[model samples]
Target: MTMAQARGTTDGWPDGTFRNPVLPGFHPDPSVCRVGDDYYLVCSSFEYFPGVPIFHSRDLVHWEQIGNVLDRPGQLTLPPSTASSGGVYAPTLRHHDGRFWLIVTNCADGGGNLLVTAEDPAGPWSDPVRLPGVPGIDPDLTWDDEGDCWCTYAGIEQVRIDPRTGRTIGEPRRLWSGAPGAQAPEAPHLYRVGGYWYLLIAEGGTERGHAVSVARATAPGGPYEPCPANPVLTHRGTNRPIQNTGHADLVEAADGSWWLVLLGVRPGGGTPGWHVLGRETFLAPVTWVDGWPVVGGVEPVMAAPPWPARPTPQPPARDDFDAVGLHPRWVSVRSRPAESWSTTERPGWLTLRARGASMDERDVTFLGRRQQHPSCRVRTLVDPAGGRGGLVVRLDERHHHGVEVGDGEARVLVRIGSVLATVATRAVPAGPVRLRVDVLAPAPGDWHPGKEPDVLRFGVESADGTFDVLAELDGRYLSTEVAGGFTGRVIGMYAATGSVHFDWFDYQPEDGDGDPTPRDGGAI
Candidate 1:
């Protein structure tokens, strides 16, 4: 399929005011860079085949997905033993000397730290340049005024590297471990601003205690001093709606203002610790104090966007399967079924040939997109003629819930590790069926400070008939807290026993809101 640019025309929503989670649903460990009046960002994709998802924007408030850096098997390879959160870790995007560079770690099968370069942000990027000795993850690169380049990584370690080859030029030096009490010092970024080198890191794990901290020194490798107030920003121990706030990237806007792009989770009220939408990308303004950067607290909803209006391309609500291949937003767990799926087999239908691998296996036959909202509905029309597989809400291989039609039975099944529970089942006639899943707000709990759990309802229908409710499952089982992964809930179509065909798939938020406005005349 030819590469098409995804654009958003946000002329429908009210001007100026915007929402939090600028990029919602599993868009974690965000890294961003600015060039002239345009802004570009990239996020971690873990076991997802496309690796890093790239976004473009003129104004910081709005963003549209341009393309993925690793779109082919030649660029990245995920082994069968790779865990759901084990393929690609945090990725850093940088624009220097008129070229765009991406550095990431593929944690599967010893696929360590590597680099890929492209002249265009929307890329046909180069193959991986392995950084053999750079240990740990979340690697960042910066150039000094003296023409020296340095790499700072997860263990709070630094080394000089040759940009041409991923070879180290010096010994790995240990830096400040961050504040006294925080744990898991990772996601390190260095910036040279105003004669001072600012170093940023996220610590205290990525759960309730997660936070963003800062330290600065006169040189790249420091005798760094931690900020007087320590953790520059965090939502831990607070009653705020956004939680697990950390893993941030800083960019200077065209208007000379500093903005922060970070990952945060929006927990449902009453559900407390349960969150199904996963860690999302959030935006906030930054203010400087005594040459130190401080992040402005983020809210669930922003009354006004900080930057001028810009155009953003939004993902379509429904996919017709008429294109030559899948949309850019469509992704698969670990290895995608290259020969197991097709769109041209039946013209307008998407055909999925059944593989013996079930949903619990790493090489399952599945195609999915991020579940972007708490209150949303996903439905797909499938022809399961003497076959199986339908719509599935997946957290990982072992933790997933699906409403499948196969083996002459239509059922809703939930699997947690070695245990499998069938929620509901019914007999189905031999033709096509429509499967739908609705995500409802969580019931309030006493321990939860206004957080909500994802309550999922499954149903099925035929031709002109109405949907029949099968079962309701709590979404917390598919959450990061329970499933234990660096990914969010992905809802999509899959087949298991026999070949199945999907006619179309639809997705939309319950609120029925449209795209945000694009910057004036900046649509591409």
Candidate 2:
């Protein structure tokens, strides 16, 4: 589909207050840059092919994913054995000298840190130039007044480098390590705001204690002074809805207004809340205070930017799989070999040739998109008669829940760590069947004692078009807290045996009123 057709329009908020997660669901470690009137952002994509999702926005509030930085197989090579959340780490996108430059770390296959350049943010990006000497993850690139390129990384270290060749000009030097007692100080970004060079870093780990700290220096490498306010932003010990806030990048609008794009999570359900959608991108206003930047609090609803709202088209809730290539939102585990999947094979349908026996195996042929909404419903028409396969909601291979069709039976499977079981099953007539998974928030009356983040219902749609829920699972099990990973839940299709053909897939997001937004094209 065309770019305009692929995106859905949204009504601008009348009250001038926008929602929290500007980019929702699994978009973590956000890095943003502005080029003229347009803004571009990139995020980390761990263990998933077509890494580093790139987006475009005019107001920074509404974003449309333009493309993936590493769309070609040669640009990103995530081995099948790559562990979950171990391939691509934090990526910093910057525009300097009439070219868009991206630097990031690939934790697998000894890739280390690398850089890629593209004339257009939505690109045919150049092959990665590996930085063999630059060590550590979350690498940030900046240029000084004299055109000297500086590389800052998670260890709070800096090194002079040549951008074109990825060669270090000097030895790496240690900079400020953030708060005195803070642990896991990482995600360092360097910026030249005005007279001084500002060094921003995330400390106190990326968990509940996550925070953003800043320090400024007269020179790129120098005796720096920390911001007296220290952590300019954090939700740690508060009753706020959003938590684990940090790893921020700053950008100045064309109107001279400053804004920050950072990652935060929204936990739900009972005590020790669980976050299923993963670290999402949140926008907060930034103002200069005493030559230091003061970041505004991140809330579920915050004041919009001063500029008139420029809302971009959101991705369609449903993908028909009619296009020759999969949409940018559709991603596969590890590597997605051309031989394993095809749209031309079945014309309008998406066909997957199973490489592994099940989702439990690392090499399984699975294609899915991030569970972007807190409450959403996913459905697909599958002709599993060719072999065993179905729809699945996954948080890594160990923690997942899904329904599969095979041998004249539709079964619901749950895998929580070591224990894997078929929780429910139903007999079905031969032919194509519709499988559905609904994640819904429990009503006030539904919360008896120990509540869950949400409720996940898995089943099949009957001929009458009514959904039959075979099993209801607690949404918390598919959350990052229970899964123990840097990623969140991804719901999609997979083949377990032979080949599985999916006619179409639908993802309907529900608003606070529990009403699902209209489908992408109205009806199937």
Candidate 3:
């Protein structure tokens, strides 16, 4: 975690701008909710699927997903995930009073937590009530301006809640107990304002003691208190290599300022733990001061803050997938079987029909996208016309990796979940097997190895040696913090519900100047 403290601060300010995970790839545990300049966010997609995506911002730094609240498959509970387990975890996008809700915790199967609505947050949302006896695992829902509505998860023996309506809630008192002080207590989040009732949570857990505390209690159950900076948004003692940082969510900005979306990365490298570019989406600049809430002002650096001036139309990163479904920022690891791939039967081409070749570890069907560059180049035209569709970067199903196509036989599979070591067979390029992969990193003062390799000290060592760094950028790059699941990034086209279907899927990302080049893959 050293290279002069992992470096990460945008320098002189202004290029693509600066700051903590302000929405990078595979966004995690974020939950913003503003509504005047219009903001709306949602994250935590565990087993991935079209679950809880829905983004849309006006100026909180260019975001635009706009749909996906469990897009199908009975509204979700997607199993078959490994890197960890099945779909939906830590979601809470509220609009309240007039309606907008979303409150999830579908850790897989209705063990509890689930509610949906839509006064429109770009959603048609509904279907998914199940809430009865809920307990923990990132829930969040606070109302009180007088409207009442509390619900913050992670149990000790219930924890403080009172929902009782949108499907039932109420009865939770276990109070505090977190940090290495363990005992669940994860991602709670509640915030009432002046009279106080903070709660907040995310205590010393997520990884390397992530921490983001607060306790306050005026009612809503509590003996609460803490927050004297009790591990506020931690690094344990600032050795800084960006290990975990507690799941969080709190938004104000529309003028009132206040921001803190949470989730950080840079653990090991090349494919371990965070899997480069995954646990993304960050931003901290909350300063309520005298009444609490204060971050990134006294220490804890990370940079990239100055993106607000004309962003309501930054769309067109190019997607000719033509849309009919999939795009609320697209996500999929489970819940995808309609035969796994299709497009209204195909029109201009985006037919990735690989019903069953390899989706990573515990059974996958990737449509992935979220490695965001330290060196990017992912060309794909595949026609697994001989079998097994291609092009992936998954980080689960054991520790996935990719580059495939199998019509006339061409491969490069790397699986680590159920272990596929590295296949490497090639031959399908007689026509359009295209395939191009790139992951370069290591450039700052240049020593060659990943200067910020999360904390493995260096990088590269994967025939199963187990070091796990995956993402740690801004110094010599290396960006890949993907995390067990809870999705984001979702690139386009797929097929193999049981067979082939890559008539076309041109993913683009290649400006590569490290040398030895051959650029011109399609789709912007």
Candidate 4:
């Protein structure tokens, strides 16, 4: 069944359990805070324009994208030279006094850690207050009982800061490093719980060995005591479906219970499995044992919280391109200039003016959304007569797959590293044509002992509503393991030359039953 159909239904789950990764696909470094009965969450948006996507929920299980924190060009700017995963990093969201505050790191040139505040969570957030004094990524903000603010960052460092002026009140000092000998200690969060100030952090890199450790002290800056059971959460060296679990944030519910929101990946296929959906946000129960927090195991499914589940409606599967502005899910590479894309240029279509010659350039005029599901179908109606453009699934400039419509033909193209090749082509009549791509799960007999993550089938549809598949490529080439990056696959449309108008774009999540067969069959 489609994701929309699966929403709000509890079929086959009679034990009142909910699935993990509440926020799926490419949503990493999740930080959540609860204000009153509402919960707000923000995730790292590396290299994507309109950085830091934020969500709001009442039940914590049902999250809706209210808007992005850095929606204006003034708030975020990524030059064409910005690398694949080199723009915005981890963000910590918190509500203090009468406003919501966010602190994050921008890795782009002339960028550093910054803070923004708003009276409303879904808002016109204030322009960034650049924190030139903060010297690391994943900056976290917390306040002591006396209302003094402190900034904690990836180095496991801390400093007293004046939030209003973005100035450091004192020199930064080192905090407790995570579990002994852990590499790449980062993503630190300082919290004041009960009578002690707890410092939580992620270490051992963000790869397979990622883990979360904690320490506490009676004072914000003091001789802290490490939790006897440190490394509170981790999936390292395990056969579990979820891997690379760490970078967690804690929130206390109004009911006095606590929850942990963290990031993890579901790797598919064989040995040295590859993950294409990027790191996803997962939820787990947190209980205190001997004054130390104990994190529950993360799984594909787990028992529901004490409160009743409230599932929000999923976003529409199809975008008609009639709105005045792009939705929060829509994102572009590097930057999205006003002249580069528009919806009113063609009224009911999205018009994109090409800047780069092809997807090989980082400045390509492309707009896409994350591939949120393991198996899904994406298609777009494009009129190539105006210029050359079509639907593409991109990992980066060097790794992508696309179906190009130009010169009266629809050609399937694949780019892996330095190689870019046309796998198949088919001539089509003029006017607007439908181009489609299907990400299907791997079949049992697909590989002898080592299985592929998935198969991506690229093709076109005829007036009779039949899809003519052109080429099918292994999905591993577009995964994080093979691509050597921190991002996942983003599927959308682009203009390779001149101006191209997309009549509409539709994305639907398919059933994940490991069936490699095509849903529709027709000759090219």
| lDDT at residue 149 of model 2 (Cα atoms) | 95
Best by TM-score: 4
lDDT of each: 0.82, 0.88, 0.57, 0.88
Which ranking of candidates, highest TM-score first? 4, 2, 1, 3
User: Against the hidden reference, what TM-scores do the models get?
Assistant: 0.93, 0.95, 0.35, 0.96
RMSD of each: 6.6, 4.4, 18.5, 2.4
Cα lDDT tens digits, model 2, 1-524, are: 11222122355544667777888899999999999999999999999988999999988888989999999889998887799989999999999999999999999887699999999888999999999989999999999999999999988899999999989987899998998889988999888887999999999988899999999999999678999998999989997989999999999999999999999999887878889999999999999988999988898777888877778877888888889988888899988999999999889999999998999988899999999877788999999865999999998989989999988889999998999999899998668999999887654344434568787888999767798888888878888888887998889999999888999999987655142322121100
Please write out the lDDT profile of model 1 over residues 1-524, one tens digit for every residue: 00111122445334445677788888999999998999999999988887799999887767889889999888899877888888888898988889998899899867689899999999999998889879999999898988788999998999999877999998999998998766899999999889889999999998889999999999999989889987999999997989999999999887778988999997663535677788899998888999899788798555554554776766789998999977778898776756888999889999888775578877888889999877677899888877889999999988999999876678998897778888799887667778888776543232345333656778886567466778877667788877887889899999887789999999867653211211121100
**What TM-score should be assigned to candidate 3?**
0.35
Q: How many backbone clashes does every candidate have?
A: 17, 0, 51, 0
List the pairs of residues colliding in candidate 4: none
- Model 4: how far residue 165 lies from native, Å: 1.3
Q: After superposition, how far is residue 423 of candidate 2 from its true place, in Å?
A: 0.6
Candidate 4 is scored at a TM of 0.96
